[model samples]
Every structure is written in C-alpha cells, then in structure tokens.
Target: MKANKASVEFAKKVSKGTPYKFTIDTLIVDHPLKKVTLSMGESFSYIPFRVEQVPRYNNWYHELLGRRFRNYTVFIESLGKEIHELIPNIYRGESVPLDLFRLSKPLKIKQPIVRNLSKASSYRGGLSNRNIALWHSHGWYYENTQDRWKWQRPRLFTTVEDIWSMGFVVPYITPMLENAGAYCFLPRERDTQKHEIIIDSEGSTKGSVYLEKGDGFKDEEGSGYAMKVPFLVEGENPFQMGKSRRMPVSKETFSTISFIPDIPEEGEYAVYISYKSHEDHVTDAHYTVHHSGGKTSFLVNQTMGGGTWIYLGTFRFNKGYDQAKAMIELANQSDETGQWVSADAVKLGGGMGNVIRG
Candidate 1:
C-alpha cells in the first residue's frame, strides 16, 4: 500500500467564563492502514495511557536518590493504567488514554490528531519496501532519584537504525504494523506556529520558583515536595511537575502559583492551569483562578486526574507591576493541611483557541 496524508478532527467551546470544554472526536477506521495518532509524542517519558492514581504516604518523606528501579517484570505488573488499542494504520489515531476530555482554552487545531502509522509508505500482501513505523513506548521505572522512569526514545527513529528498535512492545499494547515492520514519520505542520509563556512553579534556577503550600505554613517534617519535584523545563520532571503539591494555598494574602507577564504587555488571552494529585489521597481542591479579565472560582477533585493542563477560564488584563501576573489561589477551607493539594504551573493562550461570544 502506497500511503501518504491523514486528518484529525477536534473541538472545544467556552465553559462558564474563561474555562472551556475540549474534546477530540473518536473516529472508526476498522481496516488496517498506515496511520498513527501521536500526542506529546515528542516527550520521551510520554505514556500513551493516562495515569489513574498513586499510592499515598504520610509526613512527606524525602528520597535523595529517587524511586527504586524495579525489574522489567515487576514494573509492568504495577503499571496502573491499561494499554489502550491503537487506532490502526489504515491511517487514523490521535491523542492518548482513548477518550480524553478536559477544561481547555480556545485555540486553532494545529496538527492532524490522526496520521499514517505504518512504517512502510507502500505495502502489498505480506511483502513491502521500507519500514517507517515509529518504534516507541514509555513509562515510570526506578530512576533512583526524582525521575521515576529512565525513558526509551528512538533517536535515529526517523532516520534508519531505528528499524531494529521499532518492534519493542508491552503487555497490552499491540503493534500498529507487523513486528520488524518499517514505518516512516509523517510530518503534520499545517497549523500556525504558537507563542507560549510557561511559568515553572517549582523553584526555578532562572528566578524565584512559584513554591507555596501556604504562607508561614510549613509542615512538621520541614521537607517540601514542591522544592523536590522537577521544574517544568520543556515538560520534563522527576516527580510530577506543576502547581503546588502537599501544601495548603491560603486564600488570604496568598496564591498557589503566580507568574509575571513578559510580552505584549496584556490583552485578551486564554488561561490554563496544570496540576494533578500524585497519590491515592484525593481532595476536593477549591480554586479561584485569577487573570487579566477577573476571578472565576470552582472546585475540583485533584485526585481524579494525574498530571494535566486544565482550562481555568479566559480574560483580558493590562500590563503593570502586579497587574499582568497570573495567579491560581486555593480556596478550599476543608483542605486545611494541603496534603496532596497541588498547584504546579499556569499558561496563557498567547492569543490562541476560539473566542465564542456566549
């Protein structure tokens, strides 16, 4: 089969105020083709499935080295998320964790959610020429420090040599093409280039990291999960990065996470917040998302989601000393201890997404 070209369909609408509901449509392409639905695929540690939950610990213990590395067998057994079926190469599959829906800001669709998954551009019968399928898989392992997983990435994956590594598979995951199959990387660059401003919540060597459980509120152990978790450097972190974790963000004279505006002064921009519960401890965390437009408050059970970028709301703000900075405040009174209450990172649309009048 000589293959080339694919398409993806996704949609999002304004929610309440600045927040929006974003969802990708599920397409059915029964026959096998050369298609692949890649997501955060650029990420070495990016797992295809969503992280459901983690075991909890009291008093926040510190691990200098990192999580212990379990043997391949042991690690696979403890894998919490299930391996979902691939969208098949007859040519269509996109995103991770199958059905994915979250609070997202309005933005134009940049790349095809679906793409050709076959390693060979042309295949006939059981024989073909060229293996172009991408050989990829990732998950958490014993990094012995903060980084839980070692990561398996195909460097020359797009070049050659990677044809050997393309066949590696896990328990539940099925190969989109046959093992020893050749697949090529299809480039989907139709979307316009995006400009984004990311504020790392953890203490950044670049500046004062947005670290806060609450003011003057330090736990007994004095160990801080915020300081330990890796910074949001190109979406890389040992522990899950973003928002404040295990700290009570006091509403009074305090915000969970904050960052100053660096460009274009201020205007109408879509707002986004990234944070997730790490372990079994699930608390209904309350938040008042503040931006240039105004304040929108809501409640969320952080435990429900692993690490994710959530749409809080959108707004218009002016550029000033403290005016342009974005902030997420923890408002849940019941969440007194801030145990597992996390606030990691925040994002401004930088003039992306859709702007509905409703």
Candidate 2:
C-alpha cells in the first residue's frame, strides 16, 4: 500500500494601498482506489468551491473620518458662525464567529468609506516615530502664607489663561497628537494630585543646591516653581509643593540666589527656570547660567508665566559639582524700582545634545 498527499498554495502580488478581492475558480483531485467494488485503477474528481475575500481597512477609515470631521468643523466655524447637527447612537449587531459560515443566507460586511485624496501625502502614518515636547501656559499655585489656592495668571474673560490653555492641550491636543503616533512630554503635572511634590529641594532632588546672598530674602513655602499641577480640588494646592525664595531688587549691594545642579554626565542640557508671578515683579530679573562652555546671561520678565517651566537655551556642562559645573544664579539687580525678584527652581537635562542651540 502507498500513501498520497495534497497541497495548497496562495499567492498575490500588488502595490501598497491596492484593494484585493479574490475568488478561487477551480480545484481538482486525483487518487488511486484498490477496493474490489469495481474495476478501477485511478479516479479523478472535480471539487467545486469558491474562496471570496475583500480588504477591510477599519483603522485607516476611522482615522480619516476623525480628521475630516475636525477640518470641516474648523473651516465652517471660522466664519464667525455655527453648524449644528444631531448625531444619534445606534447599536450594531453581535459579532459572528470565524468558524461559522453563512451559506444559505447572504453575509454582508460594511466596507470602509473611500474618498478621493484632496492632496497626495507621503506619510501614511501621521506623526509616527516623532517626538513632541509641549507645555501648557500656566497653572494654579498654593500661596502658603495666605493658605489659599491662588490663581497664577490673571483672570481674563471669566477664566485665567493658565487654565484656558491647559483646557485645550491636556484633554484635547495631547490625545489627538498621540492618536497620530507621537511621543509627547510636557514637564507639568497632569494628575489629579492636589498635594505638591517638591522636586529640587534638599534630599528631595539629589545633586542640587540652593544658596542665598544678603538679607531681605523670604522663602515662600509652596510649590509651583519646580513642578506644576494643573487641576486642584477645593482647599487643595495646585502648585508644585516646594519652597521658592524672593528678595527685593538691589542695585548697590549685590543680593543674589544661586541654584546649582550636579551633572553626572558631561553633556549638553537645556536650562529652564521657574519663578512666581506677581503684579510688581521685576521686569528685568537678571539670570546667569555658568556651564562648561561659558557664562550665559538672560533677563527674564517675572511679571507673567508663573508656575510654568520656561526654557533657557541649551548649554554644555561638565560632570559633577564643581566651579565649572552647571549653575544658575539670579542677581537682584534690576533697573525697575519698587519691584521684587523671585527665584523658585532651575531645571536641566532637556536638551538634544551638547551642540548649543543658541
């Protein structure tokens, strides 16, 4: 006695984004029979069957639907008008298992909506493998001296710009960009935590030191200088939990505060400063960053953008805490009179490389 085997193969050659619909035309089988039921040596039979398949691009269609909808709304509403429509929710039928077949009855599957391209795009995957770093305007802060959640920015048109900008970025923009496949990092608090986390404090954040100069320096016992918490419950501080110091601007006497960060690796780091915003804050607050390359000075406007990490230029820093290490010093030497200078926290290590982005 001898045994025989049957084999099947499937092949298709097509370009990308081409629709494929296939159907098997014919199939045949040949076999040998040794049974004495009839005088037969070999038998050949035709097997009638059909294999039908169609491409289902649910993901691409879904993304297209969302993008088109957003574009349409923006274009229509930009003319200082409104478009209203009622979208009803309908329940689809239960899913059918793969093992089951609809032979006697018709099986219908919804195809993706196809539209002609308005413009040819090279990137089929939107923002995939892209890194985006963004931050919301400002956030709420806790004024510990007054024991209340104070608004960091001015309240304009019912809501402050801090919360207003955050309303779009956190809940809307971030998710949309992420859906398009982008890794985003906004160096602010996005959690529901009402308590403050002091990031650059002694023992709280290693390899950092804060030093103060002359008298008239006062430490504000609250966070929001180092970290920013967007949402805050009632009686809960939305500011970053940390201590920030402030002193009166000086011209004759050099009153200064310095924040030094220990660099474990010798590389380029993006310097950022966080400070409090007050009505009579110094307009020309002097800041000097001493890095491996050299000393870079920047005059920051402390009257606005409190509780947010403001980026200074990237600079090269030597490893470890030495005289040539990365250090940020704020001198209370401003031309503005009857104003105060505030210093909260200094951040490093957000740069791309040691190549300076001057």
Candidate 3:
C-alpha cells in the first residue's frame, strides 16, 4: 500500500475582474495503477458577480437576476444541480469545517480589485475613503452640426462595443462598486469626441504621481538623438495632456529618461506608463524599474496600444524623496533601428492613492 499527497498554491492578493488561478499537484508513490477522483466544493461569504452579462431586452432582465441571486444558498444549490446534470459522478458534499485550515491575518496592502459584498451584512469591509475612476470605452456620439445621434463604432451581431461597455458599466458595475463603499467618478461625461480626459494635476490623481519628460526628465549631453517637440494628434491623441516627447531610435547612443516618483509611504504600488502610438514607433522599448526589492526591466511594444496607461507590474517601494528608493528609466534604444521611442507620463500608484484598478 502506498500513500498519496497533494498541495494547492495561489497568491494571496486578488484583483477584481481578474481570475484567481491556482495549481494543485498530487503524488501517488508506488501506485501507478491506482485512480483517484477529486470532488471539490468551495464557498464564500458572498456570491461573486457573473463574468458575462445577460442579454437584456428591457430593465426587467437585471431585476430578475438580482431577485434570483438574492439568496446565496438557493443560488448555489441551483448551480449545483446544473453541475450534477453535466457530471453524474459528482455529488453534493458537506461544507468543509473551518477549523481544518489555518487562517492568516487580514491583508495589509491596498488591493487593486475591491470585492463587492453586502454592506448591510456584519462584514466590516468597506471603501468609504476610496476613490474609483470609472471609465468605459464609448457609446453614441451626437454631432451638433448634423443634429443626429450616430454610433461611435460598428454594430456587431451581439451589440456595439461602446454601447455594451456603457450599458454594462453604468447600470451594473458602477452601482455595485458604490454599494461596497467607493466614491466613483465618471471620466467620460458624454459621448462627444471633444471631451478629453486628463489627469495631470495632483488633485485629480489623488496621491498618485505623474512625471513628463520636460518636467521631471533630462538627457545625457551630446546624446546624438533628435528630440521631437510635443504635439497633439489630430484624430486620437494618446499622449497625456495631448503631449509627449519622442526621440529618434539610435544604436550609437543609449539616451534614457528617468522617472522618479515621490513615495508617500512604504508599500506595493502598480506602475503605469503612457505613450503616443504611431506606425513609426519601435516594437521594443526598453524600460528598467528600480524598486525596494530589486531592479526589473521590461521591453514594451510602442507600436500598438499607445495613449493608454499600460500596467508594468506591482512593486514594493520605500517612502522617501530619494530617487534610489523608487525610479523608472526608459532608453531610446532597441534592436529595431528605423523606429522611434516615446517618453510620456509615468504614473505611480492607482489613479487614487496607492490602489490600482483590477
């Protein structure tokens, strides 16, 4: 007779809208012929929102969903019935005893994703002081000159991209996050293209910090790289405040721009960088981040996804004014020569405080 052992491992921090993936490994010593069937049942204090939104014909669809899921137990039982039908071998099991596992301390750092749970319940979780920037793609645009409403994007078989995002975010996601104790802000007031969303001022971004090239950057003497003056894109300006600095790609000189952030406290923060995307932009833009743990480097593709805040990774930093404590540097050097490298804004922390959007 042989014994079998198994282990499950996952990260402690979870992001909202992001899946929490875990791995389970098992070892059956000296029992190759033996078979094991694992039946797992997990439960949380609250029911998680469905990943996919229901196709709604009217307002009644959302109301029905809320009513049906009002009772967590009933909802789980109903879900279990569907699962049982799919797999006959699976059977409902008793709830796992809590004492069997050792619970850890509550999370000490700011979480990117805020879980939506019942506020009236005994749970002390709340976001009373939190500020959330609620952004959706787009919807319909009204041309005052034409005096008619038109779709911003092409209509799909299911729904329009902008309309779907606006519908899902406004009616559902926004309210849930608000109920959980967050103060939400809508960046997109109307579907007009003239309305621009800019977060340059300190008050707008809360405690987060942003750095631009001319403001908090300098290049090496005789770097041999031509710097492009700040300019706004006629159609879609990806740069922050409709401006950014770019340099010609060169193999001769590695001209770099350092972004030093003033850390308010010692904690982990999500770093974001924005750039103007163009066809001549380099495919690989080298970036190095110096944090509390160590230095990490990343090669970003500047050819695509410009004008948006791209997440680098979460890193721990010390509280201080010193650049050694926390800094990000980007070099105008890459393997590709004919392309150009951009330097725009670097953001520390989430739009509000040290938290990030999950």
Candidate 4:
C-alpha cells in the first residue's frame, strides 16, 4: 500500500471508535496429500474509545505502558493528532514519572559552594575589607605571602545556601527573558530562531558556521531559500572583529546565523543581554571557555564556573537584613553540625574573627 493511503486508512480506523481484534494467521489451505487447517493468534484487542476518553488515553494510558508497548500506543495516537502534539506524547512515554514509579531507595543531590570572580575588583574598599573581616571572623586568616591576602585556612561557608541561591536564580531568570536560556556547561549552537538568543564558542579559521530555519519561517528574506548566517575567518584568528549586533525575526522568517571569532584567551566567556527588558540595565551573563592554566582556584556549585578569585566583595541589603538574618538562622538550625554560625555573627565581624588570648 502507498504510505499516504495507509496513513489515511489508519486515521479513519482510529476515529471510527470501533473495537477490532488484530490477529496473525499462517495459511495452510492447500496441502499435497492431507488438508491442513490454519490457526489464528490474537495479538491485541483494541477497545472502542469515546472522544472524551481520547484525552485520558493520551495522558494516563502511557503510564500503564512499558517500552515494548509504548510504540504501539504512539502509532495509534499519532493518527488522530498533529505531529507537534504527538511529539510531546512521545516524550511523555520516554520519561519515567517519579511520583508514580518510586525508587526502592531515596536519592540525594549534594550541594557545593560556588564563588563569582567576574565581579572581583582590584580597588581596595569597603566591600573587600568587609569580606576580609568576615573571613577573619570565621577563624580564617589572610596570608600576604604573594602580596595579596589569600584565605589561609578552611573557612565556614554554607554550600547548601549557595546551591539554593543558584537554583532560584537559574530557573527564575531563564524563563523570564525572551529566548533566554542557561546551561550548566556551555554548548555549541547549531541553529536557533532569528530572534532566539544562543551562546557558543568562536569558530576556528578552518571551520564554517551556518544557521537553520523552520518551515514556519519561510519567505523570510527576498529569496525563498533558507537564510544562512556565516562566520568569516581570517588567517588564524577565530574571534569576530566587529561590534556586537542583534538579528531580527519576523513572523514569516525564523533562522539563525553562525560566526567565528578570534580564539578566546584560555578562559570562560559568556554572552548575555545586560538589560532584563528594553527598559532594564544590561546584566552580564558569563560563559567559561578554557578553565585550565590559572593560579586561581575555581569553585562551581550552581552557577557554572565563574572566574578566578581576586578581590571579594560584600553587599548588605539593609531593608531585608532582618529577614535575611532570620532565614540564615532557620537554615543553621536545621544543619546537622552544631558548628553552623549565625549570620549576625558574620555581619557584626565577631563570629569569624575571634582572637583568643592565653
């Protein structure tokens, strides 16, 4: 049968709402001497479905299915739905619902401490001094052997606090911005909608970059052909040597462009619009390209690897200081180790730097 004809027939059968028995049979009607009989084996019994039942079958029936039976349901469901809707159905089948299929044991996601180095500064001021004071208050001393004060001993900081902050920031900020996305680690952008924002490494001299568009964005440009965004390379430089720019996306045309910039200087790089909205100030979203070969130690908890530590800064939200203090207190109360210190101790410069005299 023609593929299109078979598809039409399949759709008609699904929409008819009639129960049918699917069977397999081997023909043995004409035998040489003795007549043979053929036996039929039932494969599946399809139940007639109501229109209202379509939604339940589409949603909950997959829960009862295993990998072996999922494809069969998908094929039947696909006949009655658009391709895009069916795609989600396929994804639902692939994912095991945690609430429904609980594991025999529990799982834990460990939290770690992360520091941001991009905001570090060389100027000596209140922020830097406050961090030093806080560090000292926690029994951590500053070593001036390298002409810069470095943390000399283990310091008291909450890894869980850092992770919690990142979890909030990533999810909250990612969905808020237009075409805004975030990754635990940077990814290479193959293509994106014309208006969609993407982050990728600068292409190499020998390599080429291109953008792909979907069918919904046809007739985007004067030419009907899909648009291409190319990254030009000169000599050995991989980084782009021009001002940053944004591309436009129309209702009819959606496409992405690619380019190669001069190879980065062995460090992380991030591309983000500083402004939250057109009216907002530009915020810096960072990306790390090469993290190797540096004297600075990198700590990554929730936000991807920031930068090497240079100068630490501290900011106080006076308006919310009391609430912040209370929250920290609640967090410490739940900590297993009684050693957890109150935020007030650090805020007052006494909890971290206790100089005991004999």
Candidate 5:
C-alpha cells in the first residue's frame, strides 16, 4: 500500500536533523474462513462480515481518530491558556500549593432577597471546582414576634439559624503546569537584544543573570541594571567567567553577571524578570518557553505581576540540534502570535461497507 504524501512531508519536516526515529503503528484487518466442502472448479459465495471482540482498536491515533481535529485544536487552544499562564512559574520550577481558609463572616448578600438567599446558600454550600463553603450555627434562640400564642414557648433553634454558619471558602484557582523551565545565555560581552533579556523563573530559581547593556558600568545607567532571566537549571550556578565571587541583589543595589544557562531537558519554560519597576514593585514576571534542537529562544511578552497567570503549551522538537537550538525553538513556538500546525490527517473510512470484491 502507498503512504500519504502529506504524512511523508510532515515526517520529513519534524525529522530534519532529529536523532530519534519515529514509528507509527497502524491497525490491520484479518479474515478467517471456515472450512467448506467443494468440488474441483466449483465456486461458492459467502456474505462478508466483520468479526471482533471489541469495535475499535487501541492506539493513540485510533482513540483520537474519530474526534474532530478542529475540536482537538480548540481544546489545545483553551488548554493553552492554562499551560501558558502557568509556564512562567513552571519555568521557575514551582508547584501549585493548595491553601484553605475558614470564613469568619457570612458573605454580604448582593442580589434581591431571593437572590441573596441563593447566594448565601452557594457560599455556605459544598465543595466545588472553583470554591467551596460550609456553614455551622452557634446555639441561640430568639422570640418569634409574629407568633400569637400567649407566651412564646421555648423555641428550638440550631446554630445555623442563630448565627450564620459557613465553611471553606477558596480563591479562584488557575491550573498550573509544573516543572516547566527556560534559560537564555550570551557570551561575556555582547550587544543586548530587546525583549531578549527577560526570563521567566516560574518560582523555580531565586535569581537570574544577564549581560549589562552599554559601556556605562561607571555611571547611573549601569548603577542598577535589569534584564529578564529565563528559567534555568535548579542547581546550576549562574556566574560570570572573570568574576570570582557571587554578588547578591539588595534593595537599591544591582549586581552584574555573565551567563544564564538554558533548562536541562525538553519541556515548556516561562519568562520572568527581576527588576524594580517605576512603582517600586519588584516583580518576578513569567512567560512560556519553547525549544527546538536544544537551542533556546525568547518570546517577548508584557510584564506580569507577582502571582500572575501564564500558560505553557505542549512541547515538540527535533533532537538533532544542540541544546541552544532546542531552546530557541521552544521560545519561537511559545510566541503568542506564532502559528502551530498539526501534521496528522483526518480518517473517514469504516469497515468494508464501501469495499468491492474482484
């Protein structure tokens, strides 16, 4: 059987300079015939029927085969927000931690009386994906003024009735893809590129290093320099070649350094920077990381505040290139404006319904 041309082309593109070989497993059909008595030159006929324990085959493509390719694209797009939003933190090597808190006061009812009751119920309700709240009552009693009985009988009351009872209230949680890391490096003395300097540590590393721009090491322009430090290896130390000791960053002081290494493996990395903004907010911003052939690339993005959202999408690459190329490819792929096209084709045939016997 002949292979499809588009599939072949896609294989060629992704295989360019890649060291690893890819093999696609496909499903096969087998026909077993029952024994039949026949004479020489005698012909017989039988109705064709498919026989198998289960309907579908087990395979990655098979499972995903029937699904709308566009829907998959949409899913990846929707999921990209989560992945990209968390990439910065992932690149920084941080994990999502769950924090639970108890409500001290009943939430102020906003809607109409009816809506308020419903809102209150929602807050004092059970666990949910977004947030959860529970309610408990303090034992107390009050006279029912509307009751007409001569003396108000001892009224039975639960804590919920006396005091507003509620439980666990959670914050809006955005999913984070962890272990994402990224890095950008340059030789000791080189022209610094715009948007190329910032890196996302993703809550992974404590600090980053970048080359200082211009020859103002002696002036205010060089007094306290700032650059985006992409995520780097956890234990790998970032230092300048000629500098002997490491300098720590202080409130008003900035230290100049040599190179920042790229992540150790193939994965998503976020962009983050360490700089004192005009508002004096020292933020560790984050953005996603893309790699190709092991070379690092930089995706320029707006600055993010502390605890901002970033999504890191799925990673794919050619292995033949060195770490630097892979890193670059990662950055390029992460560009919010960059386009990513899948290589697989949509299948439509099922059984022998349209088959013809010769």
Candidate 6:
C-alpha cells in the first residue's frame, strides 16, 4: 500500500479564506491497480462555500433515498436527508451557509479550557494534535460507525479556532465545476465566472488574469478517466463534483479566458492544465502560447487524469508582468457537442512532462 504524499507550503497568513499550496513531487497511488502518474504534483486551498457537484449520483439504483437520509433536509417536496450538520458557535452570531461544518460529535473542550488526556491517550491512540484532537482543514469531517477503516477518534480536545477557519469566501454556486472553468485561488475571484491560478504575487506584472464560464457541461463519474474518490490531497481536490473545473459548451470555435497577474516575474515557464476524462463529455482545451519571438495555440482532450495536470507546452519571456498575461480557451466546435470541457488550474512553472504538447 503506497501512501499519497505531499510537501505543504503553509501561507504566512493562515487566516480564513486564505489560500495555501502543496507541491506533490511523487505520484503515489492508493492501490497498485490504479496508475496515478503525477504530471505536476501540486495543490492549493479555499474555504468551500459550496463544493462542485459530485456527478456520481446513483439515482438509478435507489429511487427511495430520502427516507434513509432523513437526517438531512427536504426542499420543494423532494425529501432529502441532512447529510451535513453546521457547526454552531463558529463565527459571530449570524452564520454563512458556505461555512458548513461536519463535526464528529461536539468538542468537550473548546477555547480557553484545556485538560490533560495523557492517560486518555488510549482512546485517541495515534490521533494527536496540539493535544486539541482536531484535524487542521475542512473544519470537521462526517463519518459513521459502518466505516471499518480509521473512522475512530471522537475527540474531547480543543484547539485554536484560526487553525480550522479557512477564510470561507462564497462563490456563485453553479451546477458543475467546469461550467465555471479553471483557476488558481484568488480571495475575490468569486465573480460570476471564477477564473485565476496559483502563487502569491511576487512583484508587479503587466496583464490581468482572466477567467470565465460558458455552456456545455454534464455530471460524470470517476470510475474511468474521471476524478477518483479522495482527489483531495490535503485541502484540495476531494474528488467532489464542486471541486473540479470545466469549460462551458459553446457554439463558437473557442470559448475563451484571458488575464494578467498584478504580481510579476520573468522567466521561462511551462504551462500545466489539469483535466479528467470520463465516459461522458467530449472536450478539447485550447490555449495561446506567447513568447519573445512569436505566438501560437495548442489543444488537448480535456478527459484524461481523474483531476491531474497535463503539460500543454512552454514559452520564453522577458522579466516583466505584462509579458506574463495568459489567455486559454476550450474550443467549442460547432459540430462537436462540447459535452465535456475541463477548465482547471493553468499553472505556470516547471511541471512534469507534457502529455499532449503541440
């Protein structure tokens, strides 16, 4: 059994809604049966107001789901169980639905109070924290007794609230992730069409970073070449539908996005775009590569790794910000149905080898 590993880059300001980064140098698969080659082992963070819709809904198998899931809520006459319970006493008095908390039984000792559970260590076993007995991200997780794995440890400890509070910035919730398109994390990128990419601004640059969303999106499963379960490496990608990104369906030759980062740097950087291939949705991502001498465009079939980056190509540029402005598009051929157009992070750096470089 190979454990998936990552090198985390903690943010200097680890506050709520702040973005953190993780670079995954090794592509270790949970099971040998599954081949997970890392094109670029990297991840970032965000306080999820709403997650991408997990397309793997087994609606066909069980028509009677609401009865069993009565713990949830019901809306519009449709019976639905409350799978997640919001953590009380987090923020001020009012609350944000996006800051949903899935706890493992309320904490016995929260802020100000502390108790020595040294003898109680037998109950927690290997689960150790600041002795607060809490996981760092995603507030608290949801689990049941049926979980045969490491589903133990209902902590009685307490820790600082800042550690768990990821700046929860709510974005415009869409039905699908790709319908919103690729991005790095920008606190305010929650505009109707969320689009941007990694790293804090190093210096002043030229062009603005651009991101948008369009048509053509459908729900899918991760069994094939799609996002497999547990895509979340630390605080990123959880294989949840709300966690992925894609390009919208279009009647035009290409639905596009453009931007120039305020932060600037100069160097030769390779572009890595993440994508997933599923049985449904046919999409090909396109981008315009600009350099000192000339510029050209490249394309790749969006369906591939369950949510892994595929190298598109590289370019050379002078030391400046404007020169770093990037524009990537997902071609929406009039004849093509554009069922699946993946729009993920357009990372600029030295990633793994390019899967499809033109």
For residue 8, model 5's alpha carbon misses the true position, in angstroms, by: 82
Q: Which stretches in model 6 have alpha-carbon errors above 4 Å? A: 1-208, 213-242, 259-263, 323-325, 351-358
Model 3 TM-score, 2 decimals = 0.36
The residue-by-residue lDDT of candidate 4 on 1-358, one tens digit each, is: 2223333333344445445443323323232433222222332223433334445543432333333334443323223322223232223343322233333343231322223434353323222212111111222234545554444343347332323433443345322321121122212221111122122222222222222223221211111111123432234211112112222223222332222222212222222211011111111211121212222222223121222111111122121112211111101111122111111000110012122221
Q: How good is model 6 by TM-score?
A: 0.32
> Which candidate's TM-score is highest?
2
Candidate topping lDDT: 2
Q: State the displacement of the C-alpha of residue 172, model 6, in Å, after optimal TM-score superposition.
A: 46
Clashes (candidate 2): 3
Q: Which stretches of candidate 5 lie over 4 Å from their true place?
A: 1-209, 213-260, 270-272, 280-290, 293-358
Off by over 4 Å in 1: 1-194, 203-244, 248-263, 278-282, 323-325, 335-339, 350-358
Ten-residue stretch with the least lDDT total in model 3? 2-11
Whole-model alpha-carbon lDDT for candidate 3: 0.49
Q: Local error of candidate 3 at 26, Å?
A: 55
Candidate 1, position 60, lDDT: 13
Error of 1 at 167 (Å): 36
Least well predicted 10-residue stretch by lDDT in candidate 6: 74-83
User: Per-residue lDDT tens digits of candidate 2, residues 279-352?
Assistant: 77876788887888768776666876677666555577777776555688889997878889988777675422
Candidates 1 and 4 compared by TM-score, better number: 1
Off by over 4 Å in 3: 1-240, 351-358
Query: How well is each residue in 47-95 modelled by candidate 5, as lDDT tens digits?
Result: 1112220121112222333332212221110111222222223232224
lDDT for each candidate structure: 0.36, 0.52, 0.49, 0.25, 0.23, 0.35
What's the distance in Å from true for residue 23, model 3?
46
Candidate 3 C-alpha lDDT tens digits along 59-166: 221233344323312111123322122222222233222322244465543322222221234324686535578777676666667888788888889777776787
